[model samples]
Target: MHGTETIPVRRVRDGALDLLKWLALLSMVLDHLRYVGLSLDGLYVPGRLAFPWFCLAIAANLQRVRGAPVTGQWRYLGWLLLFSVISEVPYRLFIEDADTLNVLPTLALGLLVARGWQQKTLFDRGLALIALLLAALFSSNLMFGFFGVLLPLAMLLVFSRPWYFSVLPGLVCVAANQWQVLLDSGNLVALLGLATCLIAPLAGRVLLRYAQGASPPAMRRWAYALYPLHFLLLLLVRQIIA
Candidate 1:
């Protein structure tokens, strides 16, 4: 009998990720603008679109780089770290309720979860478990952090499945986006925010169908710039209104 060898499975490329990242960036900008441009009106509905998309983007990146070298992942994480530091002061200045730690910390922790699960390293795995427990316990305060930790596993579950299977993770992802409203003490804006999260991913998935593997480095860099720039601009506007 001929010896059998296990073939390494390659993950399929989903264009939905890039589309989702761009969309999340847009939603985040809109959300931030409400703080700066229209704080009184409660326009958090459309802004709710950002966080889930960003989490999805992190998941997509982890999926693509699963078997690749570690150095690149480290480098990408470095960029995020740098930007998170760069954006924090401005972010704090811009939002009334801005926390000491912003979304980047959550994203970074989520990256650890994804990389740890993908590599199955003892240290990474242990750290991820710890992070997960912490995030779950403190989800109300660490919304993005909690979502980030769970996002990779969710992506892995649906990574190679048909679109129908994705529905399960998609719902979980949306639920993560606006879960506060699910509680008995809820309001109209929170309900609308939940609706927006559910619908936004559909647009992302459709865009990915046509634009997979088409984005260039220039566009990606520009997208990063939008995060801080938008915050600064909105802050300026908010100051004007005040």
Candidate 2:
């Protein structure tokens, strides 16, 4: 009798990617706490890591879906768009002095650019071009500005190319931030913030490539609720503390 063979199945969900998402979420929360009736000025340095890590996560997801059905990609963009609208009021309420719109819009645009580059479809390219033009027109009005939309594309490029090529996008990430002010301050926290912003993508890439042993809970569609809900929760906390 021939014996039946069992092949080991690879995991569909990546623990390292989930961990990166959790880190980004936590960093964003800590960053927002600075405005939530706390003396958390020191949180700024860690906050610098949030956006780049989120962009890296997007790049990782895009790479994962490279040869899969395009519907998943559209669904991802739909979620970002929905949350971008839903989170705005809560974001504004939570951050009184906020000048630009919420971060989700930037992420959505970034997704378009990354997808366009990956699929190279005429429709995708057209959408990306429109997003780029919109980003340029509203550079000052978008959270993280235009470079924010480009950061994910840069990260996608980094993932598809050699490792050392990450620095180019790292510089772009730094430029998206308030680096000049940090440099002008010339403090340890400021320097650390600059370093974190520049190295976030590289660190995320390393984690994605080597941290397969980790099995953290995967962040899924429900994670979208966290964005607006976090702001509401923080608002309640602030009210209670007050």
Question: lDDT tens digits, residues 149-212, model 1?
Answer: 5765665666556666666556666666646644444778777666666655444445555676
Q: List where candidate 2 sits over 4 angstroms from the true fold.
A: 1-11
TM-score of 2: 0.93
lDDT of 2 by residue, 1-242 (tens): 34787777865888889988998999999988888787988899899889999999999999998998899899999999999999999999988888999999999999998899999989999999999999999999898899999999999987978778889779989989977988999999889888988888888888888888888887989999999999999999999998
Give the top-scoring candidate (lDDT).
Answer: 2
Q: Total clashes, candidate 2?
A: 0
Judge candidate 1 at residue 219 and give its lDDT. Answer: 38
| Clash count list over all predictions | 0, 0
Candidate 1's C-alpha runs over 4 A off are 1-17, 37-42, 137-140, 182-188, 199-203, 213-217, 221-225
lDDT score at residue 168, model 1, on the 0-100 scale: 57
**Each model's TM-score, in the order given?**
0.77, 0.93
